[model samples]
Target: MEKIFTLFLFLPIFALAQKESIWDLEELYKTPKYEETDLVNKKGVKSIFYESIDYKGKPTKVYAYYNIPTTERPENGYPAIVLVHGGGGTAFEDWVKIWNKRGYVAISMDLEGHLPSKNHQDRKNFEGSGPSRHGVFHDNNEALQDQWYYQAVAQVILAHSFLRGLPEVDTNNIGITGVSWGGMLTSSIAGIDDRFKFAIPIYGCGFLNGTDGLMGQHFKNGNQAYRDNLLTNFEAEAFLPKATMPILFINGSNDAHFPIPAMMSSAKAPKSKTYLYVEDGLGHGHPPAWDVEESYRFANAIIHNLPLMDIQKTTWDHSKMDFSAVVKGVRPRKVTAYYTFDKGKWQKRRWNSTPGNIKGTKVNAPIPEEATAAYLIIRDVKGMSLTTEVIFDTSDKQTMK
Candidate 1:
């Protein structure tokens, strides 16, 4: 009886230890000690190595490229952003320069522990680097602290902490954007780190196990223990609900990796304001992903307290085959509905667009009878676009709503 009582008393302590072992937020929140380096010699950008969570009981360092705009700093310090690169990408000087030109202090970090190079495969690992990414959940069996996902997330949070300490950064206005795998990280981080003013994840979302993409296949085929650990401790779905900041999800309708359903699931997971910008025929890559104007506008709006284009709700009339949504915020120059009749894989489907009839704040378009899936796109005066969630017709009849 005494042993049983003692076991119950220690259960809470064991649970607490397991929680902390996933990520010690208190430690990661502190400004990480960093060292600046001259390895990158861009005109305005500088490279640095910052301390990260230890891997396998050894210290690790994260490489990053950072810069601030040449313009005079605002009295409250410049709005800042942290750029996370996708698969096979490193901290890019051009990426830092892009945001620097936009009048913000920016930092782009290499989560793979490699120095910046033109070729991803040739990028050399620096001393004291953490474990490199092998696959999404390939290293699940390893110690929690030593896993790639944990290390990557810790490095990103550490970057935010390091950036927040900068004298020229507006700590309250800092935002984060990540492409591809980086987008996946951004999604998860959005929930784990609430200090961010906003988060933009391009071509990334949670609910990986349900999609038809390779990542989803991996999750489906993975062992039960591996799947459990990833879903509970690492995936974005687990963290997005805790996010308090607004999130902008960007993706292509035919993205081979993150499909529309998974993206929608991610957008809905966050309790905070969520916006979608899934474009038809939009290709996936680091350069193309960052080229979206809506991402920049979204960040700018949030930082400057400007209003963003909001779609209140989407409605459909089965008899007329008409789709409509009430639009608010910034008035759009044009609105269009893109639909696809192809049924099997989202990646192989051909999309067709029809102009919407805009009447006041509401826009309406007719979806063809053969269309299996359709979504609305609203383009602003600046040519930037935001989209409503996709509605599907599962049967031969029009069941869109």
Candidate 2:
């Protein structure tokens, strides 16, 4: 299939006031409900329950596993993160531990309002009690009043506030990251909650309704009123433009839940310093489906205010593409250009990589005649392989979501 690439300037021109506020920050921040839990209180991770407002304006409890760093604390305090799980996932204690090991105070909460199962294998059977089918993608029943996203977004906003209230965390350095559905939620949160210093959404983005075959079909088949409601209330494309914080968009080139066009459309909305990590053969799921090292490297750099390693510029000359990157404080052992020629089916397309020459900070490579999309990958001498999102595609045509 033919790929197309468009360069849109991500300027901070959109104001947050452009979108109507769906949350009452004053009411949500009026009090704290992080009740401590005695379930497996390790040296680093602590389980807790916090009060949140449900759809009916009643008090509801949300369970979460919070992990605080035990390593040498930063002078300002430990940087923190809020971890969000995807559909069918609960508070992942292991996820919290992973961040804690990297010196961050991490909290993983369940959006479905269910506590984590005893083990990973039992998670699939644990039916969440929250509004399972409402207010996420499509909710024709009660609009925003009883939408699950309304409550979930509020809970997430409260999460950031709760983290700021903690004495062990550096409130100004906190960030949020999520997988799958959580990634989409993270996209909304990044735009909704300006308190986050940075956001890394793994295989999730907005513009779902605009997609051809992906998640967009859900909205496409619905009535126009329902489709408009979902887009206005929960789509990331609506919120990302107003987001003031920087974002790192990570996903597989062939991810089914988050297609390239939708991902690109979402990425184009953010006016902040946005980065991309679109890898070949990457798919859905957690951890391995995502790159832990790159994710943490991004978090660490942002928290410590370090320069990001990313492609800075791209120059496409018909059949050849020239690129430049800033890999601060490190040098790459080798640089390569990876591309796929498939017309439309990226999921089954095998990526062919061509070694490129790095002259100073610029990498040059001849574009494959049959290539439709491609990106640059840098394997630093430190044994870390860093990849960029598709910098070039021959077609911008809308396809399956």
Candidate 3:
């Protein structure tokens, strides 16, 4: 074995050696139009001001706001999640009050041409169902490859990572959640990065088809389907399925951009560890659903290591869940879990004391062991409990994974 140091020595940019960042916070943040941007620091929620950062070869600005939590959290690392808005959605993208009030820091950025902050829906009922209906995209293709869109993505991700990097965020439990376009970014990034421990993509996911809204349209420039082949030709499906983190998929039955079958099949998450919502009615809009509320609930469930959430009207009943166990705890480190219901040929789960993963919320392996049966299990892991069982087809249920 040999040790190597001073990486990227052969790279052109590395030769010049000047640190480069992908955020620009000076355009609107420093102006009066953004003057009313609400922010909360030592003070309660106020307005966003301005920030200057280097973006590629030019001076860039980010209109930003800060909202400190109300909880008696320590200053050394409070858990936080990033809130990204959909297309045509800007900074101060409403419903932020809900997050700010819950003792969590929430910041929103404008993802369109760094466009003005007008025409924002905020916390109000959403009327747009897709990007076309969202009413903005004048600079659509202007900032594509590592320019506007990716820059904004990096900025938002950097902002969340910044929170973790801050003296006020818990890096161990940092999470990311977004809606519509935000959801697509969330899924895309969820696959791209390993920093997040939990993720929620509401009205998001399903990029298999090219017509997906938000940023996908930007690449189209009126020729979307062609780019769709470009994407498929490049075979980008390898992205999301590579993610092993616990990701929740919050969606409606009628979402114009995402359909149930496509979303379910396109998602690569293992069944046991995934969260889902398949409700009827309610297309792609945020109202009637407030997706923020879903984000909050899922965030709390994972960040605080609390019980399963109750926000979903649909049923992922425990009767259809099965399990197996692996003994991985190293003696002194241990946990004791009990099953409340049993099903299939196997009435038990792969219950283990493998306390290696943070929160231990990720479960792999199939549920049932053989053909047909029914039972349920209330797994009480260190006082945290959740139920899931199997109703039929128990064959090869335990994967020993």
Candidate 4:
């Protein structure tokens, strides 16, 4: 292989020409600058204030809810996870509590420079709306440091560092997950920050403007110059290739906020090992679409070195779809194939499924003539299930399934 090299200004020797990084993470962490204050302890967790810098070099403080297990933990410490909420979401205490119940130390922080307080539901929440200044998107021509993404991604990494520093957290077992816009940030963070061993990004992947989804349309609303600037710099595609950890892309098959094709693009663009958890007719938001069982299952596999049931390969022809997977750890009672002819506007689509022919861990199914997309589902005897991303027959020129 040929080695590529580059020359830096004022340096005589040529250095390896590595992929250009959108984020100067080293510079962001250079000062170790942040302030922490303890807040009220509630629901088996301790909330606190995690202060850091914004894009404008101003001192900014965001709220976080963190908790250590009350019960006995492993000798080293408990596995920890940092949760970044989507747009309009604050530092939800409930998110922390959910993980605490799962025997993991957890932290949730507000990225919008909001104080984690109480929400309309009266749960401990962040006080601000959206992000600090220009919300999620800002001027593309501005210096990257002064953009919303720079601060948001930095804040997430800083939170990871903060959680790792806690005595009760097992740094080696740390992971990160997020929803919606937070999911997008999670993808970028996974690419830039190699400290996280695993990441789960729900309903948010990058390369938005490339898809025909709402976000792409949203980008089109901006001037072409700004759109081009964003596509070149802040989009997840630019950073995901650098991801060194395992990532699971979980989302609805028909998400209104993020299109399936766009999600696929982000998942495929990354160089890291990727997993999928796409559901039929799954819509946006956390409740019905967020599969906590699968997320924890994947996390446990990573943290404990347990056997994992995962898709090794999937291929589709015009009439048949085939699946190959490693199921060494699980004894599935049933394997099913799901398919849908409905395309576009995932929220309004309906999906149907049928029993798949499972020869050990290999699954084969007949694709309906009208089917546009299909996915495989393996259900263990214990009722736990794992899924694959929507598979399409790219060989066919027609768009309709």
Candidate 5:
């Protein structure tokens, strides 16, 4: 009886310890074992394979492309970035060059365990590749160490550590950005890896079950057990509350995969300051996703201590049929209210914008009758944009005034 009692007493402690050690930050923060490779020959760009956490009881390697600017570096070292590619994308040399030209050291890695090839889709996996992504929740029943999401996050964290160890890289100024699925990973990492100076997650946010995308469908139709596993172990929502770094959540109002509601939830999850940039009709793809100027501006603002655009609060006056937002930081050159009267899935809803009246720091616009939801977009004089949290009218009667 005493032995059993003692075991029960320690069970909760054991469980807590196990939960806290999920990513093993101490181990992941260490410089990973790596080997340089010459498979790709883009000028000034170097490719390498870094060791990551074990998978299915075997070792794994993550391929990456890194480059430094030819321009003079700061005394503290050049600010660096780790780029995580989305699903169906690989380590892109062009992506690295874009950052290198901007005078920032950059590294982009293939999370799918593929080698650099002319054809990204047909690239072959090198030996010791970790598990490829099967689906969002396909491997929920497997042990955490054997799951694809777990492996990918570990590899990204490893990449951050690798970049931090570089002699010419500014460890304190390193940031991360991921597009699409990679964006989802960035959202999760933002909460887990507080080492990043800032994070940009494009077209990716948590609350997958709330979206109309494949992840949402899977979460809704999946078995209760698997769903529970995903929510507990893999969902970005589960980890975002712990984020302590500034995060910029970028997405489109009509994004097919990650809808506005989910992105709002992710933006609100972080305790640290967060900004949003939900474009009116932004398309989903690597180029389109990364092409947003707000991303670069936000990263620059955070890394260089420049002012960032902040939307303080948004309110809806039903009686007046008006929506208003309080803006701060970086004077707004334009403010617009985007609203939708249609009330089905977010992706299919048509969005229309109306010019807002800006007085002092407040911007106001008239809300359309029967409007189901609305949000404000504030563009600064520099052409950078930021958004307010989305507001929804959930009443049975939609018509106001």
Candidate 6:
């Protein structure tokens, strides 16, 4: 009788707890009742709620924050850029904003166990830190078998897959960037995944752990027992061949995690295909002064099809733009300006443009108010183009909600 009474007493409490459970992401993501203001586009930032995706038949929810260039209507389909963060860090929303400032779509994917969804309600943020690397490499331990190496690899691939699936996102201009542990995954993704058009990995090195004893536990992108060899197994020199797109490898001269010479050998690409930035006294931080700015500029160039050294103009009010034509054969020293909406009436706006400009890479500029759309008119400048494109964005998106 006492046992029966105790059971009855505990049952309702258990039932009540289940009813009020806060850990259910399904309820959170499915509910469109959330305050849309929380996801509103700010001047340089914004957040979004993405529905769950099927990863290898398992239902998983993903939440990402992003920033996109100012647009009246989400473009037909914008390009994409994917950001992967280092270990122990949750989804990096900042990278999304970084590309947004450059007029690209940025998508940041958070794997499980890091950042809790506002609804996650439980604290497991850093629980999988060790297994994240070990499970993929020495993942034979049965107790932690599900924490397999491929799990992380799958997480990244799925992130790419998610980007590829968005209708408003151009599937052709996919790019990937990662830091530290993320850099390791970036290499693995570039090696196996062919969909990427460009790659930038900061502070990532290959084959060091496979041969070196100190960093061995972390060199996993696969299980050694799963028939395929380990990714950290090959030196950075060997892995260079797998990267087909242009790559900018940024690293601090003082980075403790990856040795410079070994990393350089492994990261080798054709002379035309790579840019290596070495900053003295800077450690493994991604935003280090010397390289971070350069990397962002590089990303801008790679994404926009705009040359890095030119003046860029953004239009206000989404007006149809028309700027003055060149002075015929004067080698484009000064560019004139004119604008009108709806063909109202063409009026010349007083603007000064500098000239000589290093093969017309730069023209002297004079400011013109009411400039409808901005234009760069370069004369007789031979320049190799870097195809810059925005590769990811969730804000103002027309893709699946």
* Candidate 3 Cα deviation (angstroms), residue 249: 0.5
Candidates in order have lDDT scores of 0.82, 0.71, 0.45, 0.68, 0.81, 0.44
Steric clash pairs (candidate 4)? 117-125, 254-346, 370-401, 371-401, 372-401
Q: Which ten residues in a row have the lowest lDDT in candidate 3?
A: 6-15
- Estimate TM-scores for all models: 0.92, 0.87, 0.55, 0.83, 0.92, 0.53
Taking all chains together, the TM-score of candidate 5 against the true structure is 0.92
Query: How many clashes show up in model 5?
Result: 0
List model 5 lDDT by residue over 169-244, tens digit each. 9899999999999998999888788899999999977767645665567767748887777777777878887889
**lDDT at 366, model 2:** 68
lDDT at 340, model 3:
18
Q: Give the TM-score of candidate 6.
A: 0.53
Order by TM-score, highest first:
1, 5, 2, 4, 3, 6
**Runs of candidate 5 exceeding 4 Å displacement:** 1-19, 118-120, 396-401
Candidate 1: where is the Cα deviation over 4 Å?
A: 1-21, 381-383, 396-401
Error of 1 at 160 (Å): 0.4
Worst 10 residues of 6 by lDDT: 4-13
Winner by TM-score between candidate 4 and candidate 3: 4
Task: Give a tens-digit lDDT track for model 1, residues 298-336.
Answer: 998899998778887686564578888888888877989
Q: Which stretches of candidate 4 lie over 4 Å from their true place?
A: 1-24, 27-43, 117-142, 289-291, 317-331, 380-384, 393-401
Stretches off by above 4 angstroms in model 6 are 1-59, 71-77, 116-148, 209-229, 232-240, 269-272, 286-291, 306-401
lDDT (10s digit) by residue, model 3, range 218-318: 44566655344324321123346556677777765346555432344334332226655544344565454464354566677777776662211111123
Q: What lDDT tens digits, residue by residue, belong to model 6 across residues 183-262?
A: 76676556545567777777775545432223433544454443233432222333455667767766553355654433
Q: What is the lDDT of residue 199 in candidate 4?
A: 94
Please identify which of the two predictions, 2 or 5, would achieve the higher lDDT against the true structure: 5
Residue-wise C-alpha lDDT for candidate 4, range 1-401, written one tens digit per residue: 22111111111111222376666667554434444455544566666766566545556656778888666899889999989888777777788878888888988877766655556234343432224636446556567776777778877887887877788888899999999988888987887888898999998887666455566566757477776666566677667877888888888766777766666666766677787777666657655534557788788878988766656556555423343344545666677788777655445557788887777766666767566567777776556667755565443322211
Best by TM-score: 1
Query: Between candidates 2 and 6, which one is better according to TM-score?
Result: 2
Q: Model 6's lDDT to the true fold?
A: 0.44
Between candidates 4 and 5, the one scoring higher on lDDT is 5
